[model samples]
Target: MASKQIQCEICFKEYAVGYCKTCGHIGDACVDIHNTGKVFQTHSVIMHEAVNVHEDDRENPKVIIRDASEERCKQHATERAIFLCTRHDTMICGRCLHSEHLSCGKEVVDLLREVGSIDCEKVNTMKSLLMEVKNEILLLKDDAENSKENFKTNADNCAQECIELGIKIKQRVDELTNVLIDEITKKHNENESTYSRITRTYNEKITWCENEERKIDQFVHNNMAGYLYLLSRKFDKGVSDVRSNLREIKHKHTFKRFEFKENRVILKCVFEDLEDVCEHQDEVTGSDDGSVNDVFEPTTEIQKTRRELTALSHKAKEYLDKSIKERLTVEAELKRTKADLNRVEKEIIDN
Candidate 1:
């Protein structure tokens, strides 16, 4: 029985302890550490007991040697996978070498060997690329934010300018309306004064004519022949004087009526001319002083700034579109790089 005691898998020395520190196997009997033949049988029983014990100690949650190692193979539940089948791209335990990978034609390689051969520089390069893309995206984000603020500021400024222009136009219209009203009122007052003067002169002429007719009537009623004869000559002269005055008054009245009609035509022409003047205020040259021009035309500086802002806005839109596309591309590359990095990390841990 003593000679038949369990032996250590690594040193091949007989061991009575359940665990062998030299070979790192927990069992009453140990198989060759590097041999795949009997390793499954020996490790299966030991790992099964260990898993049960670990489950029972869930409250403590202590880390076990089995927990730190690779997972056991599905076919050989206690044997950890140690080989990677390149042909099938799968992991297998030692027992799978003869059973599943016997006809694989040398495609199987040690998992540790493959993992060790990985180039860390490639991973570092990928990390650098991811960082660079991240930085570029950050810059794009900042630019977008700045552009948004600038757009808002420009829009607000334009809105304010439009409001000011509207106010100025309203003021100009009000001033024009007042000026037109003043001109119309002045013409109306002149016409009224002329009418009053003409009416008073016509009334005085009529009263003088009536008094002369009464004097003629009284002279004709007298019975004395010599007195009547003398009165007749005076009356004839008075009649001739009255006729001349009447003719003069009639000619003056006719001239005054023509003048009043001309005044009305002139007032109509003024209104029609004013319509054209207001319509083309910008083209009209009034009051050689440049005040009218200033009211019609925007300042050179303001127009120049408006053009510049329009061009800048267009450029900003183009840049924003380019930035968005670049950001999307960078994000896609970042996601792919992250996936590759995770795969590398997982491979390292598994190895």
Candidate 2:
């Protein structure tokens, strides 16, 4: 019977055992050079692409392998690999090169010599990738900035609208208040003359009484005998004097105190329930305090403006949320790109 043979995926060399007998791939293929077709080759036509970028790293690709047919560890990107060749054409990280090939103090390949022979196409590809990454970062910045400015503008506009509404409401209130205050002044002024006339009449009557009382007290003290003589002429004279003093007070108008009546806390209740101010006007209003009346409340306009502001706020929030999500995604890509760039730069330096 013929012995079973297995082919090495890298060089397509058939071997009788599991591992590649010539190169050093053990059980599994590190890279499918033909299938992936993403390696840089020495030939001008190109055996594959310059780098082996995984699907996960496509947005911000890292060079997992450098040369065509050069295999790298895709599973453990931090510990990538290379194709085993006597020509030492594979490109690998410093750690992998040391641990995998040169750990035994074998002075096999000179990295300094290899650097001069690096393909110009590889450098160009790296530059193109980096340029794309740069554009992505800039786009992210612009999005964030625009989001901030738009949000700020919306916020300011909403605030200004509210302020204008407040000013308008204040003006209306002031107008209503002025009308009420003017009415109060007119009503109160009407009673001014009556108040003055009544006060003056009262002063005159009190003056007459004061004078008569003093005279009475003097007479009583001076004529104690006359006070006991009930039918004396002195008593008749005293009665006549009292009649003379009261005669001036008689026929004068009686006075009633001037007052203004308030109808509960109607104004307070009206103002508190501003939305219902007009509806409750009948309940709030009285006989103008029997002194003449009024108030205005801006409820509908305020509510309308508030609703507009709320809508603006919601729109701004959505924009901000979208911008944040976009920024986060871009930033992640940027980070990976930068790491890839660093890896490429280090490889260049080491080579």
Q: lDDT winner among the candidates?
A: 1
Q: How many clashes does the backbone of model 1 have?
A: 0
Candidate 1's C-alpha runs over 4 A off are: 1-120, 209-351
lDDT of 1 at 60: 31
- TM, every model: 0.36, 0.29
What C-alpha lDDT values do all the predictions have? 0.61, 0.54
Report the C-alpha lDDT of model 2 over 1-351, residue by residue, as the tens digit: 111233444456533123222333322233333224444232122122234455554543222223332334443343434333244545554565556657434444434445447688999999999999999889868866876787688679777866786788889989987987887777667657656765676676677668656666766888865644543546568557656655544534333344556556876654575654223222112144643123445335335444587799999999999999999999999999999999999999999
On the 0 to 100 scale, the lDDT of residue 209 in model 2 is 66
Cα lDDT tens digits, model 1, 1-351, are 011233444455544234332334333344343335554444332322223333445543222333312555667765777787789988788889888798886898876665665578999999999999999899878866876787688679777876786687679879977987787777777767766766776677678768766655776776456756776677767667767766765665442221222468756865674444322223332246734323466334333344587799999999999999999999999999999999999999999
What is the model-wide C-alpha lDDT for candidate 2?
0.54
Best by TM-score: 1
Error of 1 at 232 (Å): 7.8
